[model samples]
Structures are given as structure tokens and as C-alpha cells.
Target: MNTSVVDCQKRLCPLRYLPRQPLSDPQASSQSASCVATSACESSALSFKRQAVRRSITPEFAKKVQSRSQVPVSRRSMRLQAIRPLRSLLHSKTTVSSALRPWGARGFASALVDKQVEGERITKVAELASEQAVRVTFEDGATAKFHKLWLRDHCRCEHCMHPETQQRQLDTASIPMDTPLHRLEVTDAGDAVAIDWDAPVRGTPCTASEFDAQWLRDHAYALEGGNAEDEDTAPYPKSYRQPRLTTQQLWAGADFQLPTHDYNKCVDNIEPLMRDLYTYGLVRVSDTPNSMEATEKFSKKIGFVLRTIYGTMWTTNPTNDAEGYNDTASTNLELLHHTDGTYIRDPPGLQIFNCAAQAGEGGESRYVDSFHVVETLRKENPEAFRVLSTTPLPYFTVDNDAHLATMEPLIRVDYAGNVVQFRHNDYDRAPLTHLSFEEVGEFYKVHRKLLEVLRRPETEFCMRLQVGDMMIVDNQRVMHGRHAFQGGDRALIGCYIGRTEYESRLRVLGII
Candidate 1:
């Protein structure tokens, strides 16, 4: 047999399925079964190749091969004829061992099997190195050191985080600065990192809890100092910036039309609604059902309805009460521009109002972008702006059912000196008991100026909301009011939602 023919047979046969033989021994050729199998495989492979070449090659190539070939066609044909019996024996329906079957017939290839086994191996482990920190090692030989204080502060155990709400319960200040990790180990499956803390009482051992491996991976920070220049490259997402609007820019359109969507679309697909709320600070949904239940459902679609003294969902209509303690919203009187819940320390972040019945005349809704007003005040009168932003004002509401009092600056600025929240309500404001005589005079000066700017015709937009129209406003960024109506029945249902839940929905929808 030619050397090339033997080499081709070796390549064609599955190496694992072939019987072991010594390649150095020339006597190996005397093995009849192996020799027969090799010769049959070679003949079959050559036949398949010849058929492919005949179909694919041009006639000119066939002529060139016929003229240049040293071996006669008759000899080649004779060898093919001799291998016919062996080919028939190999192809016959006979029992074969599982090990002799081709690769992938019984299972995956060897390389793929190795890869899966490696992937299932343990990839993460944690060990207690000292009283100060725990060392975590990953599969790739990379390691991270987590401080004891950091680990205790971020523990997600039920005692640390509320099981139902997932809110943190542990107080950072209560945790000892010298808290020590007594024991640390990786779970057997390597899906979690378990840690045991040394309690003050030696007999009472702290319960062991597991931290998710992926969570640890996500929060891993480098122990070494990184480039200082990279810290201030871009602002974080939570950092506040002034709203992208001016009085002139917002009123440039023929009408101040906010982003509007159908009520059904707003409920079913909330991404666009969230985007609009983040951008314009207000959104309107048309054709809502005329009921308080519909308003509750609309608020729940984005976040839970915030229950206050007024209830989860409150109805506002003209009430003929002679009581002096009644809220301005309960009467059929024109309301000045104001945000709700200014008397609460943490006021509702979003407010929704749905018109269930239209007034016969003169109940136009008015809205002013507090962000734009703040920008104007900041530019025109920097001193007044500074006073409003820094000085806390008294806002209180006292009735038979509830007595709420809070002191917050009319304009709130974050650490970056960007305006974050605006809370103002002339009707609900209490006496300035905490400020001095000079401070009170300066505060009133700025307070009056802010209200003047808020009520300006160009600064506020007015619209008559028809029945079945709902408007959603960012209570922190926009102030709303209503015109007094006469000789008609007007009804509106309103609700509040927390800012954290609203922003969580936006994150889940990838709107922010």
C-alpha cells in the first residue's frame, strides 16, 4: 500500500474507535481486521471525492489529468474492485460497541465535554485573613479584599433588610468600628459567600448568612487607588441638574402642549410616560375613566398610591361647608399655585389628578414649571435666590383630623449646587417663628418675589381639562392650581405616589 493511502485512511477513521496498534512495527501490516477496515475506509472516501470532483471540475481539467497521470486507469479500477468485499462487510448491519460509534452520536465531542466540566467547577471562595478584612478569590486567580465594616454594612440578611419591602433596617452608626469577621467560607456550590461575625457575648454566636456570588462580583472595587483624573470625568445619574427649560423657551410654542398619550397606552407601556415625566416634568393622559378607582389604578400602574390624611385617592368638588379649617381644594374658590403635602417632611413625589366631570364654565387648570421659575429667579436676583435656597420656611396644616408641620427651604439644592426640589404654598404656610426679624424681612422679600414670578402669565400655562383627561405632575418640579367655577358640577379624583417607586419603575423600563 502507498504511504499516502495509509495516511489518508488514518485521517478518515475515528481515532478513539480504532484498535490500538504499534506504529513502529512493520509486522503491524499483518493484522487482517485492521488492514481490511483501513482499506475499505480509504476506498469509500476516494469514491466520494471522485464523485464530487467529476461534478465540480471542468472537462478541460479531466483531459489534463488523463494526459499527465502516471498510473493506468485499469490498475486503479482493479484496486477499487478488490476493496468491494471489505466495504460491504464494514457497511453491513451489525452490532457495534458504544465506544466505537462516531463522535456526537453517543455524546458531545471530547473538547466540549472538557469545557462543560471546567465550567461547573467552583469559581469563587472567601476566607478570613484577619480582623480587619476578608479575602475573596475567583476562578481566574483574581482576588478582592473586603473590609469588615463594609461587609457588615452591606449584609442583605433578613435582619439587615426588611423581608417584605427590601428596605435597609441596620443603622450604620450602631455598628462597631472594630467589628470582626470570626469565620468566612464559600458555600459548597460556590454560589454564595458565608460569613460569621463574633458577637460580644462569646456563648451567643452570630448567625451565618450567605451573600450572592454575583452580587459580590458586581460590587467588587479595586483595592489600589485608580487615576485621580477619572473621578470627575462625568456626573453620576443621581446628580441633580437644572431642568432644561427657560420661561421664553417653554412658552415659545403656540400652546404649552405637554407630552400626551392615551390613558390605556400610558398604563400598558409606561416607558414613554416615564421619559416624558423626566424630561418635561409633566405628562397628560387623555380618555381616562371618570372615577376615583381609575385614578388609583393609574397611580398603581407606576407606583403604589400614597395614602395621606386625605386618603389613598381623594375627590375634590365644591363643598358648602362653613368651617374655617377646610382646605382650599375643598371649596369652589380659585387656588393659588402650590404643591401638595408641603407640610410633610417627605412630600409625595408625583401627583395625579383625573377630571371625572367637566365644569360648565371657568374651571381652567393652571400649571407652572417650578424649575423654570427657579432658573429665572436665580438669574435675575441671585441674592433672593440664595436666601430662598438656603433658608427654611415654615409650612403647616392644622385641622381637627391632622396636624402636620414641616420646615423646608422654598428651593432645595443638592451638594452639586443644582436645584433639586421646590416646595411653596402661601395658603398652607405658617408663621416664621424660627427666623429673626431681619431674616424674616429678607425671607418675605424673596417669598413675595417668587410668588410674583410663579403667577406671571408667561410663566404659567392654563388649560381647561375636559372630562376623562388626567394630568400627572412631578410635585417637586411643578406647581398646579385651579380656577374657580360657577353654576356647574365639577369633580376630580387625585392621588399621590412616592418618588422612589416611580424612579424604580423607570429603571425597570429602561427609561432612565
Candidate 2:
């Protein structure tokens, strides 16, 4: 090779620039020098092609580049001209350019190559065995097992899955119980796990499909006898194990306080507010602006204000609203422990009440976790719990134009029998149906028992909200009420927020 060619290759392969070892063996130096020359020639060729495809330097771009580098375009152009002959020499055989590339360029090239190599490795099967169930160990040391039924139902080929939606089309029920696997093999490059069926099962013919290595790894289950931490299982609820604090536990000392945050902090960083809500099912934000607009803005931080017959946001005080045939929330009477909007199908997930003005003596706010009460009732009085959980009660709201009503059990349970919500509004209780005379009588007895449980001294947590203090409660779990006030200026601005929206914000913040 020419002397210049060797230097060019050295420039490309900077790794060879490291100090050479003692040449006790002369052959090592020759071998190293030959390698450097070959690498430099290859890198030059690749760099030439890259430069050719790059956009032609406009005057503006050139000026910007020159300003940043403090270099003239002519000097840069002359350097490119010097490499043109070398580029032409190596272009026809493109292999040399990559080998001769500089460290940075080589690193980038290797990254792409690494990705392809990794994909190939993932599909390589390390082991395959089937006794009662089919198991596979991947080349990366990860292992997985699949039930025959599970594998048949999860086929992802175009024939088994809808190409557009990527949803499985296989009928789970139609899969035969005696389905047998003929053979299982790792595909070339280790991209997938391919399975072959021995014969037709049910009406479907023997078929084969490739399961992506990544997909298998994700869905794989840990071995049954493995350590608990190694098991792949759905995580427990974020709010699970939260203390079911009693009224005494909550207000234990004079310095006792609700989980509180500043209004601005609540808006700017929602994690604290969400954390409070998840733990206590309620949070108090202080120093909020004493205006209905501020309440609306605060509610909007969680989600949009939920509009109802009273509109998106409303004000309630002794002087402004009428104490006629309407909701008790609008009146100044001592209200009972209950959740709001039981009459609506989808009750507000969250409720916000900003105390714009303080009252004279009595109007203290009260809260109780109905979920806690339900758990107690379930444990103490199983019969009463059954009645409340099974009997559907009617809740209705009759306003000037609205006659909304809905029927649901007092205690709502999810599919897994976990308590999800509680609906109890004595003032809004409508006529009961879908029950016999004896059942109706029993329901009333259970209902009274439930109310007694909620009204327990240990269950009620009270606080007198001051001006600029706002309370945010989870309507699903926490029931709130208020005491009667006599002679002071007591005003509250309030709004509702949907639970879905509140959760969406938490998800966006990655709090849940």
C-alpha cells in the first residue's frame, strides 16, 4: 500500500493510534500496520458516500456553520477536495470505508449492528421441553412456558389475527382439549419461537406460527416454585394498605392537621395532592383565592368541572340561596353523613369546597370513609352487609327541570368483590322497588344499621374550615356533611370533578 494510504487508514482507525507494543516479534508490527491501512481505506470510502448524500451547503447554512466554528468555507472545501481522490479509490469497494472510520463514526455504525445482532440472539432458543406443559428457554437465559390453550388462542399470524386491528380471531372455546405440539424450534437469527402442530385439532388444520421473542419474554410467567419476588404478577393497588384511620387517630393532637398543600403547589405539582387523596381520601389546600373562579381553576387542575343542574360551579351561603324544596347542601341545616349526587348515574369522582368566608360558631365540616365503615359492617354484621350489598335503593333529585334518578346498591363492589364505592344520601332517598315486603323491611333495618355505623364517634373526623381553606374529597369513598351555623358570614364555593379525569391527571404525572 502507498504511504498516504497507510496514514489515511490510521486517521480512520484511531484505535490503532495507541502506543505499539515492543516489537520483539517483528511480524506483529507488520500485521498491525496492514490492519491500520485496510481500516483507513474502508472508512474513507464510507465517509465519501455520506458526504455526497448530505444536503448541498446553502449560503445561510454555511454562514451559520462558519459563525459557530470560526472557520472559512474555502478552507473546509479545500479539505474535502483533498479527500476526493481517496474517496473515489475506495467507493467501488465500499467494504474498506467502515473499517477505517474514526471512533465516533465506528461507534455509531456498531450501535446499529448491535441492534441487529441482539434481535438475532433473542430468537435463538436455548432449550425446549414439554411434559405437562410446553416450556422454552431463550438464548438470553430468559425462560417461559405456555399452556396449549393459551398458545392456540394467542396466535398472532394474519390468518389467526385481524391484520388491521391486530386482534386475535381464534375462538378460544373452539380450541380442542387434546391439542398436541409436534415440535418447537428457535427460528434463524433467534427472532421468534416457531411451533409445529402434529395434526389437525378440532376443525382447524395443523399450523405453525412464529411468536416474537420479545412478546414471549414480556408475557412469560415465573416458575411456580421460584421466590416470591421473582414471580411476575400484577402489582397490588397503589392505595392498598393505606391506614383506615379513625377520627381519634386523625385528630390526635392540638397540632393535628389534614393533609394540606398550598393552592399554587396543588396546581403546579399534583403529586402531593394526589398522594394525600390516595392515602386519606381527602386533602385540604390552604391560601386559595377567596373566589368561585379560584375554585373552578383548582378543580380544573385535576380535571374539568363536572356540570350538573347547579352548573359547573356554584356558591352556597345562608343569605344567597333559598332554603326551599331543593338539595340540603344549598341550605344551612345540619346535614347527615352522605355522599353527593347519588341520583346521577356517574356521580362526581371528586368534590371541591372552598371556604370563602368563615361562619360564626357551629358550621364544622365532617368526613367519614364509608369504605372503612363498610369493611367494619362486613366483618361485624354479615347479614346487614349482605342486605346493603344486595338491595338496590332509589335515589332521586327533583329540581325545576331535572328529575334525575338512579338505583344501585348502597355498597358497590367490583368484579373481584372489592369495595369500590358507597352511595348513601338520606335526603335523596326515593321509593324502593324490586323487593318483597319482608325484604323492604329488612332493607330499612340494614340501612339504619349502616347509618349507625357511619355515625359512630370513632368514624367521624371533623374540622372547621377557615377562609381561604379548600377541601378536596374523593366522592366515591368519603362522605361529608356539615353542622348548622347561626350568625356569622359563612360562604362556600364548590365544584365537582369526574373521577376518570382525576385519575387521568395522576397517570399523566405518573403518580399511580
- TM-score of each predicted structure versus truth: 0.56, 0.61
Candidate 2, residues 413-449, lDDT tens digits: the string is: 8655777788889889997777899998898898888
As a TM-score, model 2 comes out at 0.61
Cα lDDT listed for each candidate:
0.61, 0.61
- Where does candidate 1 clash, by residue pair? none
Best by TM-score: 2
lDDT of 2: 0.61
Candidate 2 lowest-lDDT run of ten: 107-116
Tens digits of per-residue lDDT, candidate 1, 1-512, equal: 32222222122232232112222232343354345544644544444334323222223432333233343323333222222211223331311111111111111111101111122222555555554777666654556577777777766554554322334566767667887666677777675578787653222222444565534543455322223223222122211211122222233112567789898766545556767887777888999998887788667777778888776887787652444436888778898789988999988999998988778888899888888888888988899899999998889887758899989998998766778789988899888889999988888798888877777777777889998899998898889898998767787888899887676555333334
